[model samples]
Target: MSEAFVKGCEGLPWWRGAVIYQVYPRSFRDSNGDGIGDLAGITEKMEHIASLGCDGLWVSPFFTSPMADFGYDVADYRGVDPIFGDLGDFDAMVARAHDLGLKVIIDQVYSHTSIEHAWFEESRQSRDNAKADWYVWADPKPDGSPPNNWQSVFGGPSWTWDARRGQYYLHNFLKEQPDLNVHHPEVQEALLQVARFWLDRGVDGFRLDALNFAMHDRALTDNPPVAEPKQRTRSFDFQHHYHNQSQPELIGFIERIAEVMNGYGARFTLAEVGGEQAAREMKEFTHGQDRLNSAYGFDYLYADKLTPQLVREAIASWPGEEGEGWPSWAFSNHDAPRFASRWWGEEERPRAVKTALALLMCLKGNAILYQGEELGLPQAEVAYEDLQDPEAIANWPLTLGRDGARTPMTWTDSACAGFGSTDSWLPIAGPHRAMHVAAQEADAESILHWTRKVIALRNAHEALRCGEVEVIDEGGDLLAFERRHAGHRIACYFNLTAAPLALPEVSGSVLLATGDVAPDQRELAAFSALIVETQ
Candidate 1:
C-alpha cells in the first residue's frame, strides 16, 4: 500500500495544503467493460490515486442523472447512477479509499437538479402543492417573453416557459437543470438532509458545485447590459449576472451546510465559484467563523495566457489573515481545458508540465489536480461526429469545447488503452498512449515520477503546506516566491518560458530541481522550476 496519507500542521486543518486529485468518474476507468466508468472502476484505481501521493480524491458527481448535463443534472440525491454503479459499489469504493488513507470528496450540485426530479415534478404540478414553491417559478411577461432579462449559461433566456405550471421557471444552466428555490425553508431543510445522508456514508468531504447560483433575487429584476467585447459567446455573456445569482441570503445557507458538516469529524467543504465577480463572492461564501472551509476562483481556468503577473495576481488574493477564508486552486478540472495545451507549445510541454506541477504544489491553497494530468496528457482530438458535450455541440467552432478534456484515460499501449475493451464514451487521446501509466512507471524520469516527487516534497515541508506566500518577483518569464511558516521557509523559483536564461547567485540547499542544473550551477534551463531550502 502507499504511504499513509498525511495532512497539515497539528493546529491547522487537514485541508489547508492538501493536494486532491480530481477523478471525473466517467473518464477515470471502466470495470464492467460497458464503455463507461463506475464506482467499481474507481475502487480498483484507488491505489493508483494514493500512489500519486495526493492526500485525497475528489470524485465528480455519479448521482442518479439523466446524462442531460453529464451528471450535473442530478435527478436523485440518494441514488447512484446505474451507468456508474449502485450504492454497494459506492460503499466499496469509499472503503477502499479510506483503507489507502486517501480521503474521498464527492461533488454535490446543490444549486440545481434535473427537471425530472421528484421535487420539480410535484412542484410543477400546481401553484399550491406541498412542494410547489420549492423551485423558482414565475409568470411570463405580457408579450409572452421570459419574466426577466436573465440568460442561461448554456444559451437563451434563464426563464423557461413551462406549460405544466403555466409560469416561467428559472434555470441558470440548461433547461434540464432547473434552479432550486433556496428561499423556501422546506427546500433548505431537505438539502441539509441530503448533506447529512452523504456524511453518514463514510465520505470525507464535499465540493459544492456552482454554489453561487443557489439563490437569486426574488424581485425578478432585469439584469442590465454590459458593453465592450464586440464578439460574445452566449447570451449570458451579454449582461452582468447580478440579479440572477450571488444573493446575500446565500451565505446563511452556506453556514447551514457547514453546520451539518461539523457533526462529522474533520469533514471539509469547498465552494466552486466562477464568473466576473467570483473573486468577491468566493471571499463572501468562505469567510467568517461559520462559512465553508475554503473556495476556488476561476482565475487561472480561463486565462488566455500564462504570465508571471497572472500567477502573482491569483496567489496574492488569498492572504492568510483573520476572517479571510482559505483559498483553493485548480489549474485544470473536468469543465476547463487542460493547462498544458492552454499555456505551452508542443516542444516546451515536457518541461513545462513538471514546472507547473511544482508551481501548483508551491501555492498556499489546496490544489485540485485533474485526472490524467500526471501523464502530461493534452486536450484530446475529438472528431465532430464523436462529440458528447452539449456545450461544445451547441457552439461548435466558436468554442474550444470541454469534450476535448473529457476523453478516456490511457493506461496501456493496447487496443483500447485499458479504459475498456469496446468503444468508450469519448475516444482516447491520440498521443495519450505514449504517456500511459505503464510506460511512466517504467521510466523513473517521467513526469509521473516528477509529480509524485514534488507532491511528497510539499507534504514533507511545513512551510509549503500551511505557510503565507510572499511574492518576491514577478517579471518577464521568471516568477519567484517564498513560503514561510513557523520560521521554516522555502523559496521557489521558476522559468516559465521556452527561453533559457542565467540565474542569480543561488543560496541554500537545492530541495528539488528540474532541467540541467548541478548543485553549483547558476543557469536555469527553459521551463525550469527549483525549490531551495532557505535560511
Candidate 2:
C-alpha cells in the first residue's frame, strides 16, 4: 500500500469511507433460545462482525416496541424491549462492540411512534391535553373527511380518525405508528432528548429511519398527482409524495439533530431517504457540514435487476464533492428482497452471489451488508400463511413479504439451521441450510471468505474508499469505473451477463478477482467481477 493511500485513510472521517455491516436484530442470531434473535445474540457475534474488517455495525431497532411494525414502532426511545433484552444488555453490547473496535450505530425512528408509546397515547387522548400537539393531529373537514388526500406508504389514507380527540391524526405508515409533530418546539426538544439519551449511553451514531418523513408541511397541502408513470409496486408510488414527505423544512431539523450529535464528538447520522426526489433530498440532508453525515435511498435496495446501466446511473446520481453529502449504498436490506434471488435465476445463484458482493464493496461511499449476505443466503421462500409483513400481506403474490429477508441467519447445519434450539420465529429451510455460516466458513473460496478479503482490500486502498467515481464505459454486460482520490486510482469491473466475454484493454494491476481469468481472452464466466489498481 502506498504511504499516500495510508495517509488519506488515516485522516478520513470515521464514516466518510467506512464499511458498515447491517444487522437485522431479529434475524442475526438467537442466543436466549427464545426463537428470536436479541441484543445478547448480537453481542455474542461481535467477533464475526469485527473479523469482516468493517468499520462499524448498523443494527436495526431493538427499542421497546409493540411489534406492530416489528421494532420500527418504538414505544420507548430510552429503553430496550423485553423481547430483545433490557438496558443492561444494551450497555454491555455497546461496551463489547467498542472493545472489538467496531462503532455501534443503532436505529432512531424519529418520524413516528407506536400508538402504545406514552407520548402518542397521551396526545391521542384529547385536544386539550398537554401532549395534544405532540402528534400531527388536525381537525377533520366540514364533512368529517380527511383534511388532505395524502396516502400512507402501507396502503390507506395517511390520516386516521381519533374518537377521543375528535380529530384525525396523520400516520405515514400503519395507524399504530402515528407521525410525530416535529413542528412543535416541545416535540423537537423531546426528540433531542432521545438522542442525548443514547449519546450518554456511548452509542457511536444513529441510522435515522424515514428521515424525510419527519417533517411535513404545516399547511397540510394535498400532495399533487404524479406526472410520470410509476414502475414500482409501492402504494406511495401512486402520488407525487410532495407535501407528505421530503419537505424542505426537514433540512433545518436535520441540522438540529446534527448539532446535537456534534456535541457528542464524531457521532455519525445517516438518513434512510426515499421517494420521488430521493437523490435531491439525500444531497440536501447532507449538503452542509452541520447536517446529517450521509444518506442512503432505495436506489439499489429495491432494484429488481442488476444491470451495468442501472449501476452506472445509481452511482452517477449522487456526485460526492466538497459541499455535497456522501452517499451510502446497499444492495439488500430488511425491507427488500435478497439481491441474489432478485438478480439471478435459481440455477446461477452462487456466481451471482460472489459478483454482487464484489460489486457492492467496490462501489464508492459507505457500503452496508445485510445479515446473512456474507453467507450467500438466498431469500427464504415464505408461504402466504407465514407472511408477517403488513405490506406483503396487503399486496400478496405481487410482493414477497419482508419476512423472506428476515428469516433467521443460518449459523450451522443442525436443527433450526443453528438459529435456535427450537424452530425459529421464522423458518430456516431451503437453500439457507446448505449455505449456513458454519458450512461456508470451512470453505476457503466461499462468498463469505471473499467478502472479508474484498473488504480488507478496499480498506487497504484509499482510491476505493472516499474517491470520486467516473464511469469508464458501461456497455453490453460489462460495467467499468475508476475510483480516484488525489493521484491514486483503481478500476473496478463486473460482468452481469451469463456468458463469458473478452477482457477490455486496461492499464491496471489485478488486485482482486471473484473468478479466474482465462489466458485466451475468453468471455467472462457468468456474473464475474474484478478490481484492479491502475499503474
Best by lDDT: 1
lDDT score, candidate 1, position 350: 88
Angstrom error of the Cα, residue 143, model 2: value is 2.0
Deviating ranges (above 4 Å) for candidate 1: 1-8, 518-520
lDDT of 1: 0.87
User: What pairs collide in candidate 2?
Assistant: 500-523, 500-524, 501-523, 501-524
lDDT tens digits by residue: candidate 1, 93-157: 99999998889999998889999999999999999999999999999889988898999998788
lDDT of 1 at 12: 70
Per-prediction tally of clashes: 0, 4
- lDDT (10s digit) by residue, model 2, range 1-535: 2345447776666787788999998888888899899999999988999988888999899999989989999999998999889999999999999988899999999999999999988888877889989999888999999999998988779999999889999999999999999878899999999999999999999999999899889999998877675545765667888888887877778889999999999888999998778888888899978899889868888777988999889888876667888889998899999988888888898878888888888888889999888988788899888888888898888774488999988888788887778877777758788888887889998888988988888888778887889998846668888898878888887888887766677656778877665323435666888777784
Q: State in Å the error of residue 183, model 2.
A: 1.0
lDDT of each: 0.87, 0.85
> Where in model 2 is the C-alpha error above 4 Å?
1-6, 227-235, 518-523
RMSD (CA, Å), each prediction: 1.8, 2.1
